[model samples]
Every structure is written in C-alpha cells, then in structure tokens.
Target: MIETVENRPQPKAAPLVVHVVRQFLPNRGGLEDVVANLARQTLKRGYRVRVVTLDSLFTTPDDKLPALETIDGIEVVRIPWTGSSRYPLAPQVFRHIGDADLIHVHAIDFFFDALAWSRLLHRKPMIVTTHGGFFHTKKFLAIKKVWFRTLTRLSAMAYRRVVCCSASDLNQFIQIVPDGIAIENGADIGKFADAASRRPERRIVTLGRFSVNKRLDHLLDAMTALAKRDAGWHLDILGAESDLDAADVRREIAVRSLEKSVSLMISPDNQTIRDVIAKASLFASASEYEGFGLVALEAMSAGLQPVLNSNEAYRVLAGRHEAIALADFTKPDAAADAIEDAYRKVATEGSALRESLMQAAHAYSWDAVAERYIDLYRSIEITI
Candidate 1:
C-alpha cells in the first residue's frame, strides 16, 4: 500500500508544491513508491504538497475513485485519463497544476514534458526525475536514439534539475542531458528491522512486477538448473503481473518440471512481504536492469543475502559491498552456480554480511534523502 503522513497543522509558511507523475497511488511500481514516500517526507517538512496523476487504469482498477481526494495529509488530483496502463494520456494537465511554487515531474511522459515546456515560457521552475528511463528493448532503443532523445533535450531546457535514481542511470542520461544528478532511492530500514529476524531456510525469494525486463523467465531456468543438483532449494516469486504474462511464467515452470520447487504469490500485501523475507535464506533477482533495486535493498536490511543478476546497477552495488553476489543471467547454468555459492556463503559468513548490508541500508535512509530533496527545493526557490 502507498505510505502517507497526515497533513500536519503547521504555520502556513511553506510553499505549495505539485508533483506530476504519470500514474500514482493505487498504481504499484518503483516510481509510485518513490513519489508516495517523497510526498510523505515532504509533508513532515511543513510543505503543502499535492499529487497530480492519472486515474486508476488496468493495474489499479477497482471502484471508480474520486478525481480529487486526500491521502496521508496530501491532496491528490487525478486528471482525465484514457488509453491503456502502458500508454496513459492525461489531458488538461496544466489546468490542474493550480498555483504551485514548483513542479516535480516523474518519468518521461510527453504530456508532462509539454506542460514543463509551457512552464518554461513563464520562467516557472520544474524538476524532472527520469525513473531509470523506459525498459530498453530493441524497439525502445531505436525510439530512444531519435524521437525520445530529441524530446528529452527539448524538455531538459524546461527543468531546473534532472534527477537520476542511480549512477548507472545518471551515466546513461548525461550522454544527452549533461546536468543530471544521481540521488539513490532511500529505504525504510526500521520497518524491515522491526520484522521478525531472518530465519534462514533453504528458501529464496525475488519480487517485483512480472515484466520482461525483470528476466524472471531466466530466473526460473536458473532455479531449474540449480534444483537438479540441490533438491532442498526452493524459490518464492512475489509481485503483481505486468508486461509479462503470469500464465507464461507458470507454463515455463511446468515445462521445466519445477512445479514443486517454485511458487508464485501474486500481489502479496506488505505484511506478507515482511514475513516472506524474514523466513528466506536469500533474495534473488534475475533482472537485467533496475533503477535502484529497492526490493533487494529491503531484503538486505532484513538480513537476507542477495543473489542478483549481472547488470550495471547491481554491479555498482556489488562494487560497494563485495558480499552481494552477481550472476550472468543470460546463462542459466552459470547463474545456478552463482546462486549455489551465495546460498553456501549464507550458511558460513551470514552474520558479518548481514551487518554490512544493514550499514549499507542505513547509508541511504529516507530521513537523509528527504533532507537532500528539501534542500534542493529551497535552493531552487531562492534562485527563483
């Protein structure tokens, strides 16, 4: 669920801010969680904040919700929306911005980009944070080479600052937009620390939407390869269905005859997530790319060793903390070997690794990260 803080009754000296993201609350994803957490922390700093986002589409559709509603002390304004969840179109976005002192744009949506461009005409300051950019498929890469690059450059002119969630993403963005900042996402260490301590089972876990970029299919293949050697090992896949079809993942498990060894828990709640991580021997992700790998960080905070797929993002993390293991996900056989080694390491040197991971998690706490954002906001305000 989206975390929120009740609007505090403080002296009205703080500036009003409007955060524009493609889709928010009820829409579960890394960007959604970041926006919700930032908003909550911003409220604590005495700012009057509101979110402008698209209405609940396929992923979050239930009963029709109000266009304007209050959640955790912040007002959320939903604009008119159409199209599918992947390609959301929010019309009349400018009309909803109201009298905000600054605008914080999330993702690289054309509608928001156009609005920011318009804001520039009035010397209005806007901050743009590309949430790790879009998943880099061949088609997306082709689009990024031409159309998206031009769009981002033109939009970059409108932003006061461009934020990237990881150094990997910052490197990628600076090729076209030079003034980008890499501020890693923060975690709630206390929440996971409060959960029941890690009770190592041979059980492993990985979480996030079942999307193509996640390389979950490869994860299953690796699990199958490992299970052949160690029948005691098991995997739990938890998260909502996304770009990848859930049925296809199940079919892969069946084809590999790993039905008994792998279990998929779709859309598990927060409490369930804590319980699963608390009992797991390790947390594994076969994702080829990640913004900040928040789930992996949370698992580390809970004292679970992480077995990550080989990628630039995790490589940066691994470089910082050598205990975090990485495997070549493109090769299931090799990935299986890496997972096996990480599992054994947990049994041997688990306590020291757990302490190191907890220290790493504390280095990126929300309290400190929020203060960085507030400081940025104040600095921008001074210049304006």
Candidate 2:
C-alpha cells in the first residue's frame, strides 16, 4: 500500500509532466533517497512525475521502492544506459527523456544526462542538483576537480537552474556558475520518529557509504578515544561499502580492538535504519566533508542529539539551528568531549529540547522542498 496525494491542483488539460534523471534509484545513499522522495512528493502535488534512471544490471525491476509504484500519484520510468561510457549514454538518456516539460537531473557529476540534455535536448527546461563534489584524498580530489569544472561549464550552458543540497555545495559550484540556488535536503521525520520509538537503548550511530570521503576511519578513531574515557559507550556504523578502502577500515577496527565496542553493518532499508536510530542515544558523523548531513537530521528527528564535525557543510546545515551541537574534531579531545556533552544535553533538557528538534526537522519536509523546486522550474524562461 503506497501513499498517494489524492487532492492536488491540476493544470487544466493534463498534469504538468516532469522527468527526474539520476544514475541510480532505490539502491542506497543520500542521492537515492533525495530522488525517490522528490518524485513521491511531486506526485502528491498532482504532477505527472517519472523517474528516469540508468539501468544497472545489479538493480532489478522487482526492487521495492516508493517511487517504483505511484506513491503520491507520480509515475516512474527507469531507463537503461546501453552505452559503456558516459559519452555514449548521453544520446540514449536524452532519447528516453523525450517530450518531458521539465528534466531534473540529480548527482550530475557522474551521470551523462546533463551532457546529453545540453548538447542534444536543448528545448526542454533542464535543472541539475549538484549533490557535492567528491573530496576524497588528494588524488581523488584532483581527478574529480577536473570533472567538476567540466560539468559546471556544461551545466551553465545547458541547464536553466543549478540547485545544490547545501551552501557548501553551492560554494563549490559558484566557481563555475555564481548564482546556483541552495535547496537544503529533507528527511521523513515521521518515519524516523516511528523508528526511534521502537528501538531499545541509547546507542551512538553513524551512517554513510564506507568511502574515503566519508572519513569513517576518523569515526573509529573517535570511538577509540571515547571508549577510553567512557567504557559504556558503543557505536554502530551503517552504510554500503563500494570502495577498496573499506578493507582498510576493517583492518583499523581490528587493530584498535574495537570489535566489541563498535559494530559495522551494510546499508539497510529506511525503516530498518530508523529502527537503529530510535534505539540510539546520539548520532555522530566524522566525515571530513559532506554535501548535507541528512542522517544527522534524521537522528535529530528521532530525538537523538547530533554530534558532528565542525565542517562547513555541518555548520551551514545545523549551526543556525540549536538542535545539533558541533565538534572541532581537529583537537585531540574534541570528539570524546562532544559525544559526552551531547548525551548530557539531551538528559538535562528532557523532552522540551526534543520537541524543538522535531519541529526543526519538519521544516525540511519533502513537500516543502518540492515547492522550492517548483518555483525554480517556473522561473525558467522557455527558449524558442
């Protein structure tokens, strides 16, 4: 039983059609969540929304997805990329997205749709959401930097609007296009709330793909630091491991003898993740960089206090809001102290602070986020 918006405004003759382009759907990670949620929300608003995604041999048609069915009344069409490289796939993707009023591409860094839309399908109003530039290690950053430049240049020429998940992401694109819009990502607070209530214990949790950019090793280091001070503290690391460096993380955890204190799990479904967050006391992230900390927001929604690095993305997302506390992980003892402080703050403040955090979380609902995108879409001038 999928949720659909029954009462919605219609544009007289036919529903306003939109094609959402992405590399993958219903797989895992923040980008997948964003695409799925946006499609669902748009369908709720009565728009004829279809998700256009790259066909992966790994992802099957039977995969469970809210967007897979007409959740909120949106249609989804997953297209296969027949070509081997990005350049060859551009024509195929553009062909699939034919005749759509608006084409919204997410994670434009790795996808070929943006280049295709720019070079081939110039008639349609295209928008790109730059999730974030991958800032892994020095080598990864150097390689991605070139891609970033090329994408930005192509986007400036082809797309009507460039949207970023956070101010930090917008800053990265500003080098290419100065006026990109910042639309903060949203979370399903209700789902997270429901998940948290069912789980037991106040466990510390961190969520993300196990990649170098995620800086998960730092989290392990922080856990080691925290365990030395508070023997009762435990951590759960949950996410997919697609990179080779994940082997390194396993070795580090073993060497530190954190097998008991820390637990590692692969990516889980939204409800399963919520269940973990509900039982947890605090949510912690050690990423050196982030486009937007959606997991931290989910933890906060679940009434778990957030302890995150004092990076630009976290600061922008959680700073003005009092729901989360910041930690300067650059210091020797900052991570340990931050975690302790988060627990104490939640304990002392009681349900009042929790209520406020939940309220803040609602401000980032997908429905509200959809309105921002709609406004951006309407603002684009159709070229003859």
Candidate 3:
C-alpha cells in the first residue's frame, strides 16, 4: 500500500537516488526523520534509494553505527567523519555516490559544500534540501552570514535544485538562490494520532533533541511558571542526547525544584515515548528556531495543543492552524500564559479540537512530498 501522487512520468530506467546526510536512523531528530521518510517514500515509487550518512552519532561520538544496512528496502551506507560535529568532513562520500543518478544532500553543512565543491569529480546531477541553513543558533552569526552569502551561494550553484524545507528557509536562501522552492518537511503524524487524554488535562509533553536551538532551559522556565500557578501542571520531556545531556537537564530541574513535576526520558523507545504522549493534553516548545517545526505538527496529530515559540516557521504554521498557540518563550511568564490558554481551549473543545489538529497534520504527509521528489529526479534527463 505505497500511496503516491500519480500523473508524473518516470524515466525509462529507475534512477539510483543517493541521499547524503550528516546523520540518520540511530540519531533521531528533525533532519534524520526528513531523510528517512524521503528515502522510504521515494523507494516505493520504484526509484533506487540509498542513504549515505556519517558513521558516528553526533551526541555519542564514541559509539559507531553499522557501516552498511538495509532499511525499508533502501540501502544505507555509513562513512567515518572527522572534525567538529558542526561540519564533520567525510570526503569518502564520493566513493559511495558513484552509482547514483541523482544526489540529494540534506543540510547545508560540510557535505553540502564539499559535495558541490567536488561536483566535477562525481559528475552526478545533484539537488540539496536546505534544513534551516545552519542559522539554528546565535553562535557565530556574523561568520555564518558571510559564509552563507559567499561560499554557500557558490556551492548552491552546483546543484540543479535547491529545496528549502520551510518558508522561513526559502525566504532566507531565496535571496542567494532566487530559484529555490519551499518543500515542507513531512512528519510521522500517525505515530501518536489522537493518543492524548480524552479531555486533555494540564499535563504537557515535549520531544526532540536537546540541541541548543531547542531552548530547553526556556521550556523549563515556562514549566516552572506554570507549576507556580497550578501544581497539577506537569511536563514530560522525551528527547535524545545532543548539545545538552541528561546531567544538564537534571541540574536544571533540580534548580527549579521540579523533580516531581517534570520528567525526562533520554532516547526512549517509540512505545515509551507514545506513552507520555498518550497522557499529555498539551505539547510545548521554547525553540527559537526550527527548519519546519515538524515536531509541533506531530504533537498536534496526537491531539495535543501545541504551544510553540514565535519562530518564523512556527508563526507561519500557527497562522494556518488556529488551534496552535504562539508564545514568547524567552519570557517564561508569557510562555506559561500561552500554555495555560491552550489547555483552557482544549478543555472547552475536547475531541473537536483534537480532530481538527489531526486533520491539519495529515495535510503534510509524505505522499505528495515523495511525488515532488520523484518528478524532480526524473526531470533530470541525464543519461545513467
């Protein structure tokens, strides 16, 4: 039952579309989810899908992933990388992509630039999905800006397509590459569809990486504010290790004296994560940046009210989905008020609100996204 948008004609031969990314599978996050879904959906369309990723997990560098494996009939190749996690160098990428008819690079990092830099050597039709443009953090803003406008723009020229994963990204990058198109990232919305409380209470849940851009500290601050107003307001944090670790989160919770009210589960299994989602009536995030705000949509799919920060992507989403609330996460009290309002709204609307949220989530599934990628891959007209 591989559902795809029809009408687009494919090439006479199946193209081996190789995906080059900084991380995948073992490292669960927005970017990883994007590449995985794209690879899986495209494979079902009869295109050859291959994912080439860095061998080491960014959070736990000491641990290494399998060098080769097959996931959902798609071949995955993991190559070693050296240097900062920000831009780990993996020149070995060229070795694996030799058989690829089209290369899809995710994130504008080391691989994105290097692959384009060495485009002549590989001699493959290439496209890249800009997953937020590396402006996720405030760190080195000036340096990154110069890099984006200069070197990054040059690199982008090598690719036939530059796909921005969010409208915010399109606005930021379109200045450099005017022809770029916005392709919203897809989420596994059914992962927790309508799994929340029957009449959603004051309980909340947040899931993702403990990355710096996630602004977990601000989220804790908001929880602290909410707890002061209603002791019953609890928060369950389900996330993987990233820039922040378990110890850092524990330290934060201890400072707020919220050991009982706030819970943390690092790298929990799917069912376990869903268990928290099942009990939560609200999902909140204090992130200052998101490429496409995929997790918020997933929370909404579970019938949980999303109280997200006023980031560009989130603001755009909230405009489309009225049930979603916006907040100034930098100001904990303001964020707490937004969360309170969301819970109140949930209490009033109940199943009606939940159904609407789930309906909104389905609008961005992988079906149409895969169709677009298929059309782009076939439009290459390059001989294999």
Best prediction by lDDT: 3
Cα deviation of 54 in candidate 3 (Å)? 0.8
Better TM-score candidate (1, 2): 1
Q: In terms of TM-score, which candidate is strongest?
A: 3
Tens digit of per-residue lDDT, candidate 3, span 4-40 = 4333333347878889999998778988888988987
Q: lDDT, candidate 2, residue 168?
A: 84
Model 3: number of backbone collisions: 0
Model 1 lDDT vs. the true structure? 0.78
Comparing 1 and 2 on lDDT, the stronger one: 1
Q: CA lDDT, every prediction? A: 0.78, 0.68, 0.88
Compared to the true structure, candidate 3 yields what TM-score?
0.95
Q: Deviation in angstroms for 41 in model 3?
A: 0.5
- Write one digit per residue (lDDT tens) for candidate 2, span 37-133: 8776666555666666655523232343342443334555555444442222534555555657777777654453455435463566677787774
Residue 99 Cα positional deviation in candidate 2, in Å, after optimal superposition? 2.2
* Candidate 3 lDDT score relative to the true structure: 0.88
Off by over 4 Å in 2: 1-21, 57-74, 79-91, 110-122, 134-151, 194-202, 244-249, 330-332, 381-384
